[model samples]
Target chain A: MMFLSFVKKEFLHIFRDPRTMLITLGMPVAQIILFGFAITTEVKNVRMAVFDPSHDISTQRIISRMQASEYFDMTQVLHTADDINSAFNKGKAELVAVFSDRFDENLLRAGKASVQLIADATDPNQAAMLTAYASNIIADYRQELLREHRIPFLIEPEIQMLYNPQMKSAYNFVPGVMGLILTLICAMMTSIAIVREKEVGTMEALLVSPLRPVWIILAKVAPYFTLSIVNIISILLLSVFVLDVPVSGSMFWLAVVALMFIIVALLLGIVISSVATTQVTAMLASGMLLMMPVLLLSGMIFPIENMPVILQWISNIIPARWFITAVRKVMIEGLGVSYVAKELAILAGMAVFLIAVSVKTFKIRLS
Target chain B: MKKAIEVENLTKRFGSFTAVNAISFDVAQGEIFGFLGANGAGKTTAMRMLCGLSRPTSGKGAVAGFDMIRQPEEIKRHIGYMSQRFSLYEDLAVWENIRLFAGIYGVPEKEIAPRTDGMLARIGFESGRNTRVKELPLGWKQKLSFAVAIFHEPKIVFLDEPTGGVDPLTRRRFWEMIYDAADRGISVFVTTHYMDEAEYCNRVSIMVDGRIDALDTPKNLKQQFGVRSMDEVFHRLARENALTSNAN
Candidate 1:
């Protein structure tokens, strides 16, 4: 019963501070829209320079085919190799395709043609993607040529992109955004709020009260937990309706995982508050310590498989990584709870461990 | 008269340093007990242990008949603590702060409204009931905090330098509130550096270097020390401690 009053006071504190209210309520929508549209890994409308000396039907066909695809925008037609270098230097094109003079003859006589593709390797990921797209276009052109000539001596590898067939980057980001934002808002806000009491000396009054130390920590976190749930619903809604991100799995399982993750975040916040004596220190600890790891190691923006072996090992310990994987499995893979059981168990274990440590630390600090 | 608080050989040590070293004292049920000490004289530490906020390293103490070590929770229920810092929610309105403490202290829902209104009127802040605590003047905040501390009417209210930086007039007024609370059968265990305020207490203990060097009525302490004022009494005791430590 006393706990309920503490929760009420916490809510009043949140609602009265417009800055905190704005960050808690407004951040998720803004972040979802920002991540969905502005921040994307999928390359689109990539500018390319084509140097086709032959100007033959085959070369024209390939260039036109490349232009036809949504991925490439043929920005310049280079007359010489010098133009290719200048086009790259001036940032006029990300990819340059050069064909030899006898390209059409070689295709007709030898059933294959050499196309040299040069890409600026400044951003290795984007460069690799652009090169892959060019190669795919050339391969498609080769298949069309063979089909038209009635030739059947080619190996065609059929590719299928499972789970996310359209390859929408938004599908990947929505779940990550859910993990990052929830962890950020829940962990950072709870820690700062608790430390604010300590900074202002009200925590002493609270400690001297009849409320148990654990109950006081719970009351401090209860409001943030509610706000996080609201954030989850809003983020999920935005992902589904606005960004067209699908929730193929059961909403019940998703909510279960989300609640577990939120608890873990809140426990982390409690641990932080126990160590931090000031609001600024709490903010710095949560923002720097939690946000950076969640963003980089959780596979939020970068794929975990692509990280170094040691980094991958480190990422395994990040709670958000498990949560993001679980969310992806549920939201995109349409998998049942059985598919995400390991992730769920790990998250639950982390929640228990963090809660235990935080409670112990808080008790020590209070005494 | 019954004892509101009892302490014997209360010693709190932080590793090698003794913060409150084996201090012993008692307060009558309605007495205003002034606890005075130098900056690092362990007054806050002893008060913290008595309030059940901190455990005594080794001692026996009780507040309102509850053991300090074994029944700290019971001690919490029957005592109020006001720290040197104005420890109230600055963002909350005056009445909301009262209601929050009332609720935490388990004041019934039915009594919260009347009690809150009464507290506001008593503090002469009925007009500012809706004003945020941060907007109130420092003196008013201190007064409101004191009023809230005693709102639950605990057997004992511990004030830890409740008038640290307030003006002399305001501090005097605050002492009046303390006297009023004490007169209502609530023992006031107050710690202060203000020697003049120490004179108002029924009895005062002057602590130097974690030990109480003197404990008596203000008039008696003055006569015993052959001093004209409590300030002189306090200065003589503190200077003697400094001189002894230097000799060591």
Candidate 2:
């Protein structure tokens, strides 16, 4: 009964502060929409400079083909090789497609053509992706030409992009956003809430009360738990309805995994609050320690396999890595619980370990 | 007379230094016991031990018939604590704050409504019951914190410099509330750095360098120290400790 009132007070604290309410409920929606539409991995409308020295039917045909594709915005046509350097340097183009000065007579006699793609590799990931996209478009055009001219020596490889046929970044980001948002709201908010009580001196009153210290922690965490659930639902709704990300597996399993991750995050928050003496320390610890790991090392924005070996080893310990993997398996791949059993078990173990450590630390600090 | 608080050589040490050194005292039921000391004099440390918030390194104490160490939870149930920093949720409405304490202290559901209404009327701010605590003046917040601390009607209430930073009039009104609680047989264990406030207690103890140098009625302590007021009594006792330490 006392615990119930404490929970009610927690709710009152959350509702009375409009800023906390806005962050808890509104942040996830904003982040999902922002990341879905604005921050995308799929390259679109990439400005290209075409150095078509040949100026023949074949080069014009290839330039028109690149223009027709959504990926390349073929706006600049360079006359000299010197223009390639200036065009790239002036930021007028990200890619310069240089075609050799060859007449149609050479292609007809030798049945061969050479094209060079020069891309600015400042952002290596985007540079690699843009070059691959341009090459793929050129390869498509070659296949069509070969089919028309009955040149049977070239072997064409049929590539199928399974799971995400159109390769929508939303498919990848929605689950990652769900993981990131849940961990942030659950861990950061709960730690800040508890630390605020300590800063305001109400924690001393709470400790003096008949309410058990563990119950005090639970009371502090109860509201954020509910808010995190609401956040999960909001993210899911926004991803599914607005972003058009599909949920192929059972919603029940997805919720179960999400709940486990939320519990893990809340336990982490408790551990942070137990160590932090002030609200600023708690906020910094949560933001710097927890948020950075979840964002960078958890395979949220970057793939874990492609990272350095040491970093990949470090990513294994981040709870969000396991969570994002499980969520993608369940939500995007439409896999069942059996497929993600290892991840679920790891998350459950982490939650238990964090809870035990936090409880021990809290008790030591209280007395 | 029944004793409300009994401390026998209660000591607390942090590593090599003693914060509270062999402090012993007692207060009778319904008595206002003033715990007075300068900054870092260990008064708060001793009060914390009696309030069951800290463990004493040596000796024993009891509050409201519960052993400080073994029955800390029972002692917590029977005592209330208010710090100089007002311990109310500023975001909560007045009535909500009151109800929260009442509920946490296990006040029965049947009596909570009447008790809350009575408290609002006593504070004479029935209109402000719905106002957020942060919106109220600091004086009002301190008073409300005291009221909430004792809302469960604990047998003893502990106030650690509860009147610090308040105006003289507000402190006077706060003492009136303290007197009212004592008159109703609630033992008040209050700590204050203000010597003038010490004169209002039924009995006062002055601590110097973690030791209680004097424990007597304010009038008797003044006479014992050959002083006219509690201020002189405190200064003489503190100076004696300084002279002794200098001699050592």
Candidate 3:
């Protein structure tokens, strides 16, 4: 009953504060909308510089094909070798495709032609995606040419988009946004909330009460847990109804996993608050320590698989990694609850461990 | 009379710095004990140890009939704490803050609503019970904080410089509230640098350089130190120490 009242009070606090409400719900939707409309994880509108020295119908046809495709945006037509570096350096071109001289003549004689692809590897991930799109377009063109020439016995590997055939940024980001926003609002915010009490000296009043330390922590974390879950559902609903991002896995399992991770985040907030003497320290520490990891390591912005081996291992331990994986499996792949059982268990374990440690630290500090 | 709080050779050291040197004191139940010290004289540290917020590095203490080290949790339940800093929730209304403290103290839910209203009314803040604590004047906030501290009717209430920034009239009103609680058989253990406030205590103890330099009724202390008033006594002792240090 004592713990319940504290929890009630916590809810009151969260509900009363508009700033907290904005961070939890408004920010997630805002981020999802921004990332969905403004950014493309699949790499579209790539600026390309074409150098077609062949001056033949086939070269022009290829350039037309490239321009017509949504993947490539023809920004420049370079005539000289010196122009290549300047085009790339000016950021006007991501890919420089050179059609060698006599390229159309060779296609008619030996029925073979080569195109040189020089890509800016500065943003390797973008470069890689752009390269894949270019390769597919070239492959399609080659197939058309072979069919026109009455070629036979040709083998081509069929490309299959295993998941997210539409490849919308919303599908890729909604789940990650949910995880990041929930952690920031639930864990980071709640941790600082308690420290605020301490700073204002209200903690002494609470401590003098018969309210147990564990109960106080529970009260502080409980409201955030509820608020974050509400945020999760709202985001999920928006993703499905508004954005048309499909849930590939069990919605029930997805919710369960999400809740598990949220609990872990809330517990982490409690631990942070227990250690921090002031609200400023709590906010600073949680923001720097939790937000960055959730943003980078959770595979929200960057692919975890392509990261260096050490960073890969580091990301493995991050709670956001499991959450992102679980959310993606459910939201993108529509995987069942059974499929994400391991991740859910890991999240639950982390939550329990963090809560236990927080309780212990609180007791030690109080004593 | 039962001893509400007792400290024997209590010492608290942080790293190499002795915040509270070996000190011993006792307060009977229902007494108003004023703790006086210059800044950094370990008054807060000693009060913390007695309140069980901090542990004594050496020696022993009991607070509210429980061993400070062995049963701090029990002691915590039986005592209330208010710091020089206003301790109520700024965003919460006066009544809400009272109810929160009451709820934390495990006041029966059925009793919380009435108790909250009663506390507000008793503090003459019933009209502004719904007003946010931050919206209230400093004097009212201090009064609300004091009322919230003893919401559970704890055996002892600890106040660390509870009236630091208030005017004399407001401080006097705050003292009246303290006396009211003491009149109800609640022991008041308070720390302050205010010499005028020190004079109102049934007994006062002054701390200097981590040790108690004087302990007695304010009149006795003034007379023994050969000073005109409590303030002069404190200044004389502190100045004498400075002169001795310079000579050394």
Give the top-scoring candidate (DockQ).
Answer: 2
| lDDT, each prediction | 0.86, 0.85, 0.80
Q: In terms of TM-score, how similar is model 3 to the real structure?
A: 0.83
Instruction: Report the C-alpha lDDT of model 1 over A1-367, residue by residue, as the tens digit.
Output: 6888789999999999999989999989988988676744789999988998989998898899999999999999999979988998789988888887778887787665678878765444466678788889888877787789875323232322222233435477788889988887889999999999989999989999999988898898888998999999998889889988778999999999999999899889989989998999999999888889888888777777767899999998888999999999999889999999999999999988997898789678766
Over 4 Å off, model 1:
A39-57, A60-93, A96-103, A106-168
Cα error, residue B173 of model 2, in Å, equals: 1.3
Better of 2 and 3 by TM-score: 2
The DockQ figures for the candidates are: 0.79, 0.83, 0.58
The CA lDDT at A205 in model 1 is: 92
Rank candidates, TM-score, best first: 1, 2, 3
User: Which pairs of residues have clashing backbones in candidate 1?
Assistant: none
DockQ for candidate 1 = 0.79
| Reference-based TM-score of each model | 0.87, 0.87, 0.83
Query: How well is each residue in B147-171 modelled by candidate 3, as lDDT tens digits?
Result: 9889889988998889989899999
Q: Which of candidates 1 and 3 reaches a greater TM-score?
A: 1
For model 3, how does the per-residue alpha-carbon lDDT over A1-367 read when each residue is reduced to its tens digit?
6677677777777778898777766887888677665554677788998888888987787788889999999999998988988987788987888777787777777666777777765444456577677767777777787788775322232222212222333466787888788779877899888898888777776765666766777778777777787788878788778778877667777777887888788878888888899988999888888889888887776777657889889887789889988888877887777878888888888888886897789778775
lDDT, candidate 2, B51-148, per-residue tens? 78889999998889989879998998999989998789998888888888888899999899998888878878789988999999889899899999
